[model samples]
Target chain A: MKSRVIEIVNKTGLHTRPGNLFVKEAKQFESEIWVKKGEEQFNAKSLLKLMKVGVSRGDKIEIICEGPDEDKALDSLCELIASLEE
Target chain B: MNLKDYLFEYNTISLQAEANSWQSAVKLGTDLLVEAGTVEPRYYDAIIESTLKLGPYYILAPGMAMPHARPEGGVIRTGYSLVTLKTPVAFGDVDNDPIDILITMAAKDTETQNKSAIVQVVSLLDSEERVQWLKTAKNQEDLKRIFESLTDFE
Candidate 1:
């Protein structure tokens, strides 16, 4: 498994359009991607699951990817979160 | 934020309803909250504007769509409106299209208390069987029983 820890930089965190974009981007990968916040983890591919976790601004979450393209999945997800603008 | 309590309190559960278009479906859902004083009239407008700009991004699953807008977009209180259409309508979404159930949310903030409402919906919709169960509900009692049946909701 490949994983990376990143902080949500967007002012609104991961909700609304940003949340949709994150899930859509995660679905592009063949790997199983999960976002872990503290003790809780949510499926990165499901928009509702990710939103249910209630990600907010400045929250640090770990993106864990496990599959054939785990490395690519981790990098893309990390970049996606880092690049979100409000 | 009890999903069952919040939905039933405002009498927001609408089952076997009819709407010709996705916008009407959204109006029906948002109006429930509007009448109950959970939100202002502009809340529905906000939802429509966002859907138009974002293209039905609220359509979360195969038959379910949890429509919501930002808290400042005329939300007087944090609540939800549950609407189940008699016939599904297309929301211009290619993947999770033709939404049948819409749980419209109006939250005050990003706190866990508010987000737990979302978790309850996700819990009930986590399985296809549950999705079908909610979609085919005949009445308000059926809807209440369905929410009660979900033991995982907390």
Candidate 2:
């Protein structure tokens, strides 16, 4: 498994539109991606679970990817979160 | 404020409602919010406009959706409207389509109050059995009982 901790750059974090984009990006990878915020960790590919976490701006999250493409998945998801715009 | 409190106070739930299409289904839910004064008429327009730009952003599952516009889209206060359609309508979302339950939410801003609604609603529908039972709510009293019976996200 590969993991990276990063701060949410978008003003709205991963809520709504940004959240949708995050899920869409996660689905493209063959690796299993999970987002961890504090005590809660949710499937990065599922929008409902992601929205349930209600990630906000300035929040720090850990992205974990495990599978054949774990390394690529981790880098891509982290970059996506860091580059997200409100 | 709690979700049940807002629902009871605003009286914004419509069960077994009718809508010919996805847009109308959204209108049905947003109209209830408008009547309750939780959001202005423009809020509905904003939802439609946003949907046009972005696909339905709140299709939680195959049979349910929790639609809401951004807070800047004329939200008067944080509130929610529940509308269950008599006939399910497709929202062009191939993954989660033919939605029958609409939990339309309006937030004045991204405060704890609005976030509470998201957590509460997600908590209320935690199970497939729960979602099926929610579709069985035929009246306000039934919904009240259902809401009271919910134990999660307290």
Candidate 3:
């Protein structure tokens, strides 16, 4: 398994559009991707689950990936999180 | 209060309703709220004006929408009304377009409006399976059963 803890940098954080984008990114991987906010973890591919995380700006979240292509999944997702803009 | 409580109290579910446009669909929900005395008639106009400015930001997902303005938009009380369209209506949102479910909400204050009402409704409609079940629901009992099952709503 591979994981990375990243801070939400986007002004709006993950809601509608960004949440949808993040879910789209996660679905391209074969790994089982999950996002952890505090102790709560949700399936990264589910848009509603991602929104339910309520990731506001400056909040730290962990992206965990296991199974085939975990490393690539981790890198791609971290970059997506990092690239999130207003 | 939770969605189930608001829904039951208001008795505000209109299933298989016809709407020629997004605004009309929203009107269906607000009309019920007006009749229930949850919000003033001006509240409906406020919602329409906000949507015109913000686009369809309320389209929560592919098939659902939750239309609302700020509390000061003319809220008399905090309440919600739901309208499920017989045919989907497009609100020009590329992703969450062709909305079939419209849920209008009025809150006494912005702080209370920012609470878990939207989240709880999203939880109820999160899955495609649940959304499909809701779309196929034939009566108020079916809708009530679904809302009642979510006891953990906060």
Which structure among the candidates has the greatest TM-score?
2
The TM-score obtained by model 3 is: 0.73
**Docking quality level of the chain pair in candidate 2:** medium
Against the true structure, what is model 1's DockQ? Answer: 0.51
Please tell me the TM-score of chain B in candidate 3 relative to the true structure's chain B.
0.91
Best candidate, DockQ: 2
**All candidates: TM-score of chain A:** 0.95, 0.95, 0.95
Question: 2 or 3, which is superior by lDDT?
Answer: 2
Where does candidate 2 stray beyond 4 Å? B112-114
User: Candidate 3: deviation at residue A49, Å?
Assistant: 1.8
Clashing pairs in 2: none
- Across B61-122, the per-residue lDDT of candidate 2 in tens digits comes to 67888888878898998888888988899998777789999889887777743367676666
> What is the C-alpha lDDT profile of model 2 across A1-86, one tens digit per residue?
99989998777777767887888888889998999999999899887787778898888999999999999888888888878777
Candidate 1: segments with Cα more than 4 A from true spot:
B110-114
Interface RMSD of each: 2.1, 2.0, 2.9
Error of 3 at A59 (Å): 2.9
CA lDDT of each candidate? 0.82, 0.84, 0.80
TM-score of chain A of 1: 0.95
**Model 2: per-residue Cα lDDT at residue A1:** 94
